[model samples]
Each structure stands twice: as C-alpha cells, then as structure tokens.
Target: MTLKQALNRTREIFVANNIADARLESELLLRHTLNISQTQLYIDINQELSPEQEKAFWHLVKRRLNGEPTVYITGHREFYGLDFYVDPNVLIPRPESELLVEKALKLAQHQPGVTIAEIGTGCGAIAISLALNLPQAKIYATDISAPALKVARANCQKHGVLNRVRLLLGDMLDSLPQPVDLIVANLPYVKESELLAQFPVSSEPRLALNGGPDGLERIRQLCRQLNGKLRPEGYLLLEIGQGQETAVTTFLSNLLPSAEIEVTPDLSGIDRVVSLHLT
Candidate 1:
C-alpha cells in the first residue's frame, strides 16, 4: 500500500474506534514504521510502502486499537522540546506538566547553582529538562517505582544530564540526600473514586495515577514533608489536576500558612501548576 493509502486506512480504523486525533496518531505511527521524517513522508506520500514497513505499521495500529497510548507504542515522548524515552512503566509526560518545568526554569534562573529535587520523577522529564536548562543546578530525582526510575535514568543518560541528575529510589523526599533550593513534583493526583468510576488509560501504571480518596493524599504527604527538605526561601512547584487549585492551595496554606503561593493555569485555562515559596 502507498503511504497515503496506509494513513487513510489507519485513520479510519482509529476514528471508528473513537480515538481522538486519529489523523495525527496515524501519521505518527506511519512515520515510526517507515522510519521517515515528516517532510520525507510528504515527499513520499504516493510511494508504495514496502511489505516489511506495511506489516510494522499495521502492528502498531493494532496496538493503538487495543487502547495503548502512542507514546508507549513509539517508546518516546517530547517534553520541553526534548525527546525522552518512555514506556508503560512510567506515566507518559503531558503538555500540561510543562508548566511545572517552566516555573522551575524561571525560579532556577535567579538562583545560581540552585539545588533541586524532583519527586516522582517518572521518565525524568522535569528533572532532566531543568538540568539541561539550568546547567549549574544540582538535581535529585526520586521515584517510588524502580522501573519508572530506570526509564528516568535512561532518559537522563540519553539527554546527557545523567551526571547532573541523581536518581533515587524512594517515596517522595525520603530518599533525598539533602535539602534543596527547590522541589518539583508531578505526583499521582487521580482520585481513587475517579479510578473506580472511569480510569483515564488502563495501560498506564495505577501507582502513577491513584492518589487516595480525594486525589490529594500524595500532595498532602509532600506538603507535610517539605518542612526541612526545602531550604528557607526555597520554592516548591507542583502539577495538579484540574479543579484542584483550591484544595491544593488550601492544604498548602494550612501546612505553611505564611508561605507565598500562586496557581498558574495551562493554556486550557485549567489550574495545572501550584507554586509555593517558603518564608
């Protein structure tokens, strides 16, 4: 089949299954299968796909049809303009989480040699991105799941930031070697009730999604642990779920009543990042 024909068929299949962004997904799968660039694909749109390429493309399509995420199938994702290896072991990085990276970057820029810790550093996207952007920053990244850390470590190495990023295996800040100037986390915030009612993606790791009854358990735990882990005048950046602005803000206020707090919304106008500055 020709490239155009394959994409058309794949998109039709995805659309029939109610997958959003079918055209984009189909194109990505086709590019991965053909090992071709977007420009190359367009240039070769009318060219016939080799048998091997066609077979591989259809295999990936089948996986997508089975409800697997494209990032898992492609084994990579782009975050902060950098590509990171990803799989089912780690939660796929989303564009919304970039806000956390943005906030961290802005904070680190003003503090030379800023020490930072990333809680639940799945795929090491945030930590590595910060390390790349802030070359002088020392970053400690921790993940409860060793498998997720493995992915994160690989990404750190791939991005040439392994030397700057210390990967730790522990929950929250328990494994950090010392307090840091900043702490950033994209912890699991999906409520158990939400998981029970309707899980977002079954293929994703539940440990990376479940956040107790109200989706704020892990956030609360981190807040309680920030007392000594974060340096005086340090900052904490957190990526939260939609509509969680008020709850997370209130919880942090109660924990550190005098700390300065701000909520930054994503492009969709959802409260996606919560920034807290210690007194």
Candidate 2:
C-alpha cells in the first residue's frame, strides 16, 4: 500500500479503537516508522511502502493500539515547543507543567545572574526550556532516579544546555549546593491510590508518580526543606494536581506565614500551579 493508504488505514483503526487524536497519532507513528519528517511523508504520500516498511509500520501501530503512549513509542514529547526524549523511566512532560517554567522565568527574569533549582526535573524539559529562555540563569535539575537523570542528561546535551543546567542526583533539595533565587518543580502529586487508576499500568515509573497515601506527601517534604535552600526574596513555583490547591497553599502558609502564596490555574481553570514569594 502507498504511504497515504497506510496512514489512512492506521487512522481508521485508531479511531475505531477510541484513541483520542487518532489521525495525529497515526501520522506520528507513520513518520516514526519510516524515519522521515512530516514534510517527507506527505511529499511521498503516493509512493508505495516497501514490504519491510509496511511490516515495520504495522508493528508500531500494534504497540500504540495496545495502550503504549505515542510519545513513549516514538520516544519524543514536546513541551514549550521544544522536543524532549522520554521513556518509562521518566514521566512524560505535560502541557500543564509549562506553567512552572513560565512562572520561573518571570520570577528569575529580573534578577541578574539568577540561580534556579528544578526539583524532579524528569526529562529536563522544564530545566532546559528555562535554560534556553534565560541564558543568564544557572539551573540545577535534580532527580531521585539515575535512569531518569540519564534521560535528562541526554536532553541537556541535545539542547546544548549541559553547561547551563547542571544535572544532580538526589532527593529534592539535598542536591542543591546552595540557596537559589528561584525554585521550580513539577513533582509527583497523584495520590498513591489513584496512580494505578489514573495512568496506564506500568507505563511510567511509580517513583515518578507516587505521592504517598495523600497526593501531597512529596510536596510537603520538599516544603519542609525550603527553609535554608531559598535565597532571601526567592520564589517557589510548583505544578500540582487538581483538588490540591487549598491543602498545599495552607501548608505553605503555616510554614511561612509571612510569605505571599498565590495559585495559578491552567487553561481549564482548574488550580494547576501554586507559587510562593518570599519577602
């Protein structure tokens, strides 16, 4: 079959199977299979697929049909318009987390030679995006999993931000060598009980999604460590899950009663990010 025919067939199968964005995903899988860009695929739409090419494409389609994420299958995810390398070892970067990057950039933009720390940097999307945007800032990207750091490191090299964004291996703030002017994070905030139901089974690392019995376990632990790690007047921006606004902001209030705490909602109007500014 021709490339266009193969794409049409895969899209139909995906639609029938109830996959969202079936056409887009089908195109992505096809491009990945042929190792070609979208332009090449369309330009060669009428060309017939080699027997081996058709076989390889079908293999990828089967994987997507069985519940593997397209990003994991293709090994690419875009955040802040930048491509990132992701795998099961690291949580796939989501659009909502871009708020953390934006808030961090804003908080750091005015501070000369600002220093920033991104806890749970995962694939290093947030840290790298920040590094590319704010060249004057020095970023520290930390993760508890060495494998996850491996992915982050690759992305840093891909983006050529390895010199600006340092990859650290440790839990939360422990890897931070000194106080930073801005602290940003997209930590795992899904309740441990909800993780299994919310995400595909074994599709992602448990360590990247688990937040204890309640969703705030890891957030709380990080909040406890913020005392000495943040420079005076530093800002903390966090990307949190839904229904976690009140509890998280309250905890921060009690911990630092004088600090100004604000919550920013995502495009859907759900409270998605909580930012704290220290005086």
Candidate 3:
C-alpha cells in the first residue's frame, strides 16, 4: 500500500480503537516506523510502504491499542522543548508539569547560584528543564526507583545539564546530602481507590502512582519533612493530581501555618500546582 493509504488505515484503526488524539498518534507511529519527520511525510505521501514497514507499524499499533503510553513506544518525550529518554521505569511527563517548572522559575528568579531539590525526579524532566532555564541554579533530583533514576540520569546528560543536576536514588530527599534553597516535586498523589478506577496502574510502577488511601500520604510525609530540609524562607513547589490542590494545601498549612500556600492553575485552567514559602 502507498504510505498515505497505510497511514489512513492506521488512523482509522486508532480512532475506532478509542485512542485519544488518533490522528496525531498515528502520525507518530508512522514517523517512528518510517524513520522520517512529520514534514517529510507529506513530501513523500505517495511513497510505497514495504512489507517490513507495514509489519512494524502494525506491531506498534497493537501496543497502542492495548493502552500503552505512546512515549514508552517511542522511547522518548519532549519536555520544555528538549527531548528526554523515557521508559516504563519512569512516569511519563505531562503538560501539567510545566506549571511546576514555571513556578520554580519565578521563585528562583534573581537568586543566582540557588540550590533546589526535586523529589520523584521521573525522567529528570523538571530538574533538567529548570537547570537549563536557570543556568545559575544547582538542582538535586531524587527518585525511589533505581531504574527510574537511571532514566532520569540519562535525560540529564541528553540535555547537557548533568553538571548542574545531582541525581539521588532514594525516597524523597532521604538520601540527599543537605537541604536546598527550594524543594520541588511531582510525586505520586493518586489514592489507591482512585487509581483502581483510572490509569494502567498494573502496567506502571506502583511506587510512582499509589499515594495511599487519601492520595495525600506522600505529600503529607514530604511536607512534614520539608521544614527540616528547606532553608529558612525557602520555597516549595509541587505538581498535584486533579482534585488534589485543596488536600495538598491543607497538608502544607498544617505543616507550616505561617507559610504562604497557594494553588495555581495550569494553562487548561485546572488546579495543577501548589506553592509554599517557608516563612
């Protein structure tokens, strides 16, 4: 079949299979299969798809049909305009996460040579992006899973900010050598009951998504420990799951009553991030 015809059929299959963003997903799969850019696709729309290419495309289609995340299939994802390596070992980076980075940037502004810590540094997307954007800042990133840390480290190198990021393998900041000027995290916040209904939890790592019964277990623990780890008057920024802002804010308030805690919305207008000052 011609390349255009093959892509048409793949798009139909993806849409019929209930794949979200069907056209974009099909184009990505085809681009991976053909080792070409999306722009190139239109230029070569009439090119014939060899039997081997067709077979490989079908394999990827099957995986997507089974609800696997496309980033895992592509083995990479772009964050803050930089590509990062990703695997099942790490949670896929989301658009909502950019809010956390923005908050961190604003908080760190004018604080040259500032130090920051990022808990659950999945794929090192947040830490690397922060390091890239705030060149004068030094970032410490931690993850409980070693495999996830491995992916995060590789991503730091890919972004050429490894020199600015120190990677730690431990739960939260348990293994850090010292406290930082700012602490940022996008840790697991989905309650077990909620996760039971949504997400391929069984497919992804449990440690990355399960935040106990109330979905604020990790956030609570982190908040309690943050006072000791954040410098006096330091800042804390977090990316929360949907419907989690109020709970997270309360948790922060109880931990530091004098601290200023605020919930910020993402570009989509969802309460997606929380910021706290260690007053």
Q: What TM-score fits each model?
A: 0.97, 0.97, 0.96
Regions of model 1 farther than 4 Å from truth: 196-201
The true-versus-predicted C-alpha distance at residue 118 of model 3, in Å, is 0.5
Clash count per candidate = 0, 0, 0
Q: How accurate is candidate 2 locally (lDDT)?
A: 0.92
lDDT of 1 at 274: 93
- Look at candidate 2 and tell me the lDDT of residue 247: 96
Predicted candidate 3 versus true structure: per-residue lDDT over 138-186, tens digit per residue: 8899988999989988988888888889999887778878878999999
The Cα RMSD in angstroms, rounded to one decimal, for candidate 1 relative to the true structure is 1.1
Cα misplacement distance, residue 165 of candidate 2 (Å):
0.9
Q: Specify the poorest-scoring 10-residue window by lDDT in model 2.
A: 195-204
Expressed as tens digits, the lDDT of each residue in 4-85 for candidate 1 is 9999998898889999999999999999887888999999999998898888899999989888999898887999999999
* Model 2: colliding residue pairs: none
